[model samples]
Target: MLMTGGEGRMARIHCKITPLSVYLVVLAMYSTLMMLACLENEELNRVAREQKQKTAAPLQDDMAIVRDRRSQHGKWLRTVDDFFKRMGTLETTCSKMVSLGGTYCRRALDNNKVVCLDEDVTLKSTNCTVYSFGIGADTTFDDQMSHYGCDVFMFDPTVNQETIVSTNLKNERFHLLGLDIFRYNRTHMNEYPDGKKENVTGEFDTYDNIRRRLGHESRHVHYLKMDIENTEWRVLPNLVEGGRLEGVRQLAIEIHTMDIITAPAHQVLPLLRQYWQVLERLTRLGFLRAWYRPNLVLETLYYVPGENRTIATCFEVLYLRRGPVY
Candidate 1:
């Protein structure tokens, strides 16, 4: 089976060319497969983008409806994600701050009320008038103010009494009235100690009516303090709307954010917007936030859905009316 030199050279060439031809054919198949894969990926990406756009259209429409409703109400609404942060922030600056009452200043539990006394002469005068609301069982603040010769009028509906009681302080400058400040004039039902039924009835009146009744319609209230649990959210709006706060020089109030914090995720935005509107209205009324402290006793931390960290549910804020002494 021995072949000639020319024949052997031809056979060797055939063997090499066979493998090279097979390699070229396999290379072509691989290139085509890769091209098909690239095209398939591009198609998938295009379809995904289209699907996303279709989904976003409905969301945009819903937002438009929200915008329309906001416009109808004539309110500039804020998103819920940043509501707590904005609320916790101090909006104004106070040069001089004085803490009165309680055991200590800035204590977590039963902290002293912070007041701005920058160039303020009303609170130090003997003719100063103070209206203190929500006087549960503590009158330390009223007592201290009375020590300054300021007339302190205290109001509360849950004092286990049905009628208004007037008490004279040691300095004869304090008056206690069992009444509640509310948006409207109504009868507040006082519950029994056993929480069985509300058998006692107390009067709740608006700030305007109360001031008129006390003949303080034209008199300036040098200092006003309120700690009406969660009713402040309602009472404050009424006072601002009725222009009853125009004669007040300083306000120390506790604001509760529990409503927004405890609401369902879907309803959080509306509640936060309402809360923001209240603060915004106060700001518009020239109420500058001088100082704020968290109520550490009822400090509950909740992880809001859109917020990264937990937020405090309650805070005591001091707002000083900026402008004239009145």
Candidate 2:
């Protein structure tokens, strides 16, 4: 009985020892896996930090470049504003003159034949030189100025031969020419056949070329009128660059496509660019806006389609050379 009791005790001890050893082995394996996992996590974090550091320099550089470009553009706009501050101030002019044939044919020509003032009435008698571009079938403006003893040169490409033939019946002081003002000579008209060309001769000439051709190199233009459709944009710039405005006393220009008035000046668009360029050139030439009349005849180019609110598509501006208001 004693030996059997001893054997039972040994069996119980063996059973308890086997389970405890298995539990210890499982616990040590779990601990090893946890340590490996912790090491791998730390290594991954280190690699991520290294990658971010590698890309940080270039990212900062790109940010800096963007900032620099913005700064440069801002500076450019500031310079333009500074230059515009030096332009001529507004000056008022007197009564509306008579329109020849069209309702939009009138502008103040000033009092004197040489230097004009805002309050001065049109000269009643003077041998001043008046250059009128874009004469569309009506010579009333020229005739009136001619009656004032002014030598008016009227140019238009569409004037009929019969009209030129009847010039004697028209203003005797007016010289009508079948020419159109262009940035270049119309020699290219020869490329097309006579009947195919839109212009009678397709022989458009610049203002400077006309002055040289017409023997007015030294003579000053007392009054200059331009209503050449949308060609005024190109023609006016050419005249400015050629120093033609130096001798022009009073200028009446029909600036087209002014409906972009709603646009902000800093917008990177073509209209604002042209607008600034025109203003700068005119200001540099000592030209001041004396009067402005909105043109209701033309359609707005920039506004919404068919929205008839009168957006100033085409307008007449009378400019007087900046001087005393005699």
Candidate 3:
């Protein structure tokens, strides 16, 4: 059982080599497992990036569609704004502009109704005639015209009075008729002050028919004032077509754009186009705009598209005939 010294030394060397060989095998196995883990992580990262690209493609397409629609809408709004500017521009100047009805009756500091008249041509005779429409309780303009020896005929369908009432001014020259100026000769149902809707029989007529009835067909209207709500857009074309405005020297009208301002976004352009056409017709009939004032007392504001500010929906515009048409 006893070993020699050389054999004992060889056995001790074998034991030391066996432990070092086991340590090297364990280290190699750990390195292989780490390499497999790194390959699995790289595959997962690639899948996530591909999934993100797939998700973002549809969203980018949707954003492009929205931007294109916005650009088209902006272009439509700009066209409407240009038409509005043309309607408001003044074509001529009034040298002797006088604001009739000096007292403000409608919550305004100044009167929006103005008359342009030259001393030599307008209101110079006792036979001068004035027709005032839409007289709502305020007769300052009618009364002042009567004082100038002008035959003042005021018309209002909403007034609480008989068919025709004569006022005590300048030898009873002011005649207030409960009639309406319409586009046709027909009965119009108007709401009175008592909130009753009555068919105003034989009370509405076209400007030409009314002129014939009043025996003013051959005479000149020195001053014609109209504030007939939104009816001007309807009645004015008939007047121009029938040559009713030939004898009118001065016209003071209040234009209303409430229908356009209150319409839907899609309908605003069509309504404004109709309004512009009416203005163009007036211009062709030799009626030039002398002055224009936005009625601030109404406080009806319209937000013009593609603009940062608002504009008044109502305007008091005065038009004068260029020369003697008759």
RMSD of 1: 19.8
> Which ranges in model 2 have alpha carbons more than 4 Å from their true place?
1-124, 165-199, 258-269, 298-302, 305-310, 323-326
Ranking by TM-score: 3, 1, 2
lDDT of 2 by residue, 1-326 (tens): 12345546523223346888999999999999999999999999999776644322123343343345334543433432232222222333333444433433236332111223322334334557888886655666666566667777877655544555554334433343433454433322212325544344334667767778788899888789887777776667677775667667678777675535455645424553455466546645655555566555444434433465434456677776653221
lDDT of 1 by residue, 148-239 (tens): 68878877756643232342354233333333454333355555558855543446777777787788889988888988778877777777
- lDDT against the true structure, per candidate, is 0.64, 0.55, 0.65
As for lDDT, the candidate ahead, 1 or 3, is: 3
lDDT of 3 by residue, 130-193 (tens): 8888776566777777777778887765554543354444433333333244432445566766
Q: Point to the candidate with the largest lDDT.
A: 3
Candidate 1: regions farther than 4 A off: 1-81, 103-107, 120-122, 160-200, 298-300, 305-309, 323-326
Clashes of each: 0, 0, 0
Off by over 4 Å in 3: 1-80, 105-107, 110-112, 119-121, 162-202, 297-299, 305-308, 323-326
> In candidate 2, how many Å is residue 83 off?
17
